[model samples]
Target: MSPGPGAGSAPASLTATDKVSTFSSFRVRNYRIHFFGNAISNIGTWMQRIAQDWLVHELTGSAAAVGITLALQFLPMLLFGLYGGVLADRVDKRKLLIGTQAALGLTGLTLAALTFTDVVNVYHVYVLAFLVGLVTVVDNPARQTFVSDMVGPRLLRNAVSLNSANFQSARLIGPAVAGVMIAAVGGAWAFLANGLSFIAPIIGLLMMRTSELNPAERVPRGRGQLRDGLRYVGGRPDLLWMIVLVGFIGTFGYNFAIWLVAFTDQVFASGPGTFGLLNSLMAGGSVVGALLAARRGSNRTRFTVGAAAVFSSLLVVASAAPNFVVFAVLMPLIGLAGMTFQVTANSTIQISSDPAMRGRVISLFMMVFVGGTPIGGPLVGWLSDEFGARVGLISGGLVCLAAAVGVALILARIGGLRLRISLRAGSRGLALVPRDPEEVTAPAGAAIRPVA
Candidate 1:
């Protein structure tokens, strides 16, 4: 018989001590190197994100221009995401990542040079954004699936949570620094800084011990592998439902850069510092949410649905704030709920996939999650431009709310779950529990098994 997945590598089962340590993944030397490297690179990525949007706005003074840039940036994913995943399955992930990282860094430097030379224009922004998206199409899936290789099956969830923490922690710093650079010196420095940050990951990947990784089964040269990936997802109700919910929410509800910039300019009448500060606040909340997911050690489809519902509702609340302070207060709350939804949904999809098809599966997941931005980003940008930020915010939130509700209802029927409510001692609680007693518990983080 063929060796099982993760054979000759770390097992999925955890030791008692492993369970106690929330940062179990950190114990792995490879992952520790990757974690720090990713943290530095991610900070640079965040800075570029802020500077890019700001640059677009500065050039055109049109929110719609920012939206168009956002739309263009993700268009390559919609076009080539699945193909990238196919390559990831067939190619050496580490080498592919090194190439993509180098390309991305060069792209950053190209934009920085144009800006610093004072010749950057709206067309330049559009072209460069599209180019970056092309690189991201390959990089996103490879980077995502590579986590399993570094930590094996044992600390996959913990590692995923820690990755989010590292990314968000960077967000906590990157935007603030970007804002200061934009305000005090200039936006060109932010772009230049991001270009250099890619060095950290390049060094990390070079230093890693290749003998230690748990390599996934490579797909043989064959036809119909793409169809195989589609069929794999099509057959799973849990994965299907989760993807549908996130598709709606992510497309409409997560246009933060566009809206936050609008809010800063129109509502607050403030500068880049306020805009960056708000993003940093949301990142702070994301860091908190990520740490909570790590410590709680829970991963279920229900958490994905429940968090989406709460997060969308909070977005609606955020839209109605009377001033920047009230709006700022709501950002952290939104960030918490958003991170809960994102991290849990990500884990659900990754854990549910077969090892052989993990890269293709993750690519599909990201295509829907981020690729839909092209459709939503421009439209939402248009809405904000014409109707103002409050209306745009409310509309996006309501659509997200509707999507979450739809998922819960569909899952309840398929899983034979029932809603239960209790009011005692002046306390109230609500639950969606399996109708069968045996369904109350299972392996930790098991996807809720839907009845056929």
Candidate 2:
């Protein structure tokens, strides 16, 4: 398929060399080590997530508790994300990551020990989850901005997409492995494995050739840095709308992790294996979506919006599925749409933001994207507990659809552009034609670079 208008003018090309070069970011030695380490570490992270949710469900048998756990895990992001972004701008991301990972590993090990000793309780899980969330406030933004420092601008998008691909691939393997591990030795083993997994990322960080790392743009620490970052995003309508769109989908639409457990337990009357299978199916689709985004290249606002629309629609369809088999068949589609929107939104934020303010801007992006979980997770969980799992899923999907439509309409009006939707493939279905061409061009010597 040809590139869409929102994607800028990049060609759709995915050759063997491109695939190889996509990993070129790893050739930096530092990034390569970080890549492998993070890959291993993230697998353990996913394992812990599955184990944690299942453990909570087993203890309380309530979907609302699962949601509350998720909220606790993300509430730190909502509360401290902006400050975390400010810290990312001011500190060495590598050093910060090492400490955070260590803390995370310890948290996993503590939970493992607690569970293994048979002293685990729901309150313990809640406290541990909250602590993990607190660490993530700093860990996530630093990690997001650290990618650019690893490869520089030349391969930022590729690195981001590849990172996402690794995440999804881990998603595919981690849950199934965790399911088997949990079934065999129990959830404690899974948690213990996650603690052990941190060894890899720590090794990667220690072994990395820091001298070869890309020079980070050091932002001057000032009193109004937070306000500055906010103003920066406020000036760009595209970035503002993109972040808003993502926030809506993230908050109301993307509660798959929470919903999946409910669906498997309450709806399908299934076990851990079935739950793992459903997640793996979604991961398969997400992998495809990430690859497609990588192939399409940078600056695709239209594709991002379109993907949001498709993601919402897929969720709606998936919610209505009558059987597990049908739901499984449709999961990949939902995964694809979800990942597509994520990759596109992430790329747009990274490519568009000013270098000095990138960390803070991306933090805001993360705040909206992840911070919404605290607000949404409990709501979805409550809905599932009060009504049914399907209602929770369907409500999320409907909200996503409405948000997408509303954002697109607002963008169209502000830009003075007409948007036309069509079912045709490889076509510019939505074109943004300014009433005056001169007004659309970047002002001379403007700091904002045109997205390529």
Candidate 3:
């Protein structure tokens, strides 16, 4: 059975004093190669993302059109993400990744060719986006588990944090470059660069010495594997509740593409350059959040929940910003809190899960986190079109805020924890205090049995 949070056997070796270095994961040769190669590819991916959104908007001149594009890109994940995880557990991740990555590159090249030929329409973009999503269904879980393959459990958290940092750092470059490139030539060039960029990672994967890697034990082909994964998650409150919170937040609160484009054209009267600037600002904050997560000693569930609340609050505040400058300034805080919550949740789940079940577990985590985009994108897009951009943003933030508080109460109740208030000045007043241990052992209808 998969372990719950704070019950994983692998983390027992490290004590408070044995705090890991922020860059300790770099000591692994294979991880280093994987990091740099992914760095280049992530930048390319971000560029394509920005260009694609802008291209769709430019072609259709409607925020709802962009929403449709986003929905199409993520639809496959909602449909086939679990099967991809099962495949990851059964196959060699390294070889599977090569095939997926090549396929993704081909999609990029196809889009670029169509764009350059002057025959590309919104339909072509929709089809290519869908194809990329299909590749991502398998690629996402395999790539996530591959970190464990490279660095083992001890460095897994650090590597994951660094991976976020790397991707955010690329965001800093990709959007700025893409904005300028699209302005200078067109979106086609950005697509071309992203297509060519895949060569770097493919080369890196080929160069790795397979002997030194610590691959997980592959699960044999069998029936009922998907059901097994669902049961494992259902039995663990920590995993299930965290997934629930992220799902709510991801669905409603994370529809930035629609809001950003609407605000840029309608609210700020700006263009792609301003959009790129806004994205870069948020990416900068994400980098900081990632590094902070890497430097931390542990991933506490409370900390993750707190970050979610803070992120939601910031979104509400950003929605009401008086001017472009104010909204722009607030993006970093939103990004920071969001990234901190994401990194903590991801590492916590991975560290807590059984190695054999890690792929399926992470797949479920991602399925809820990202697979909700299809449902959310169009809804938010229509809200922006009918009501306004600010209204859409505020509505999402309110939903997320409510989810955070509700989940906190449920967790505390299940764990026999109570909120304690102190009237004394200069004290840590409010806290969740534990009740009698026996009371929590099998709380009425509680599914959270602590892992001993």
Q: Which candidate achieves the best lDDT against the true structure? A: 3
Report the error of model 1 at residue 348, Å.
1.5
What is the TM-score of candidate 1?
Answer: 0.93
Candidate 1 residue-wise lDDT, 192-306, digit = tens:
8888999999889988877777778777778988888887777777887888887898789889988998898877888889989999999989998888887766566777788
Per-residue lDDT tens digits for candidate 3, residues 1-452, read 32233322233334535558899788778788989999999999989999999999999988888889988988898899898889988888989999998998999899999999999999999999999989999999999998888877877889899999999999999998998988999999999999989988998999887766777777888999999988888878888888899888888877888889889988999999988888888999999999999998687788898899999999899989999999999988888899999999999889888778889999888887888889988888888889988988898898999999998877776667878899899977898888777766453454575421
Weakest 10 consecutive residues of candidate 3 by summed lDDT: 1-10
Q: lDDT, candidate 2, residue 90? A: 86
Pull out the clashing pairs in model 3. Answer: none
User: How do the residues 124-149 of candidate 2 rate in per-residue lDDT, one tens digit apiece?
Assistant: 99999999999998998899888877
**Structural similarity to truth (TM-score) of each candidate:** 0.93, 0.90, 0.94
Question: Quick one: how many clashes does candidate 2 have?
Answer: 3
Q: State the TM-score for model 3.
A: 0.94
Q: What's the C-alpha lDDT at position 91 in model 1?
A: 76
RMSD of 2: 6.2
Q: How accurate locally is residue 31 in candidate 1, as Cα lDDT from 0 to 100?
A: 86
Ranking by lDDT: 3, 1, 2
Order of quality (TM-score)? 3, 1, 2
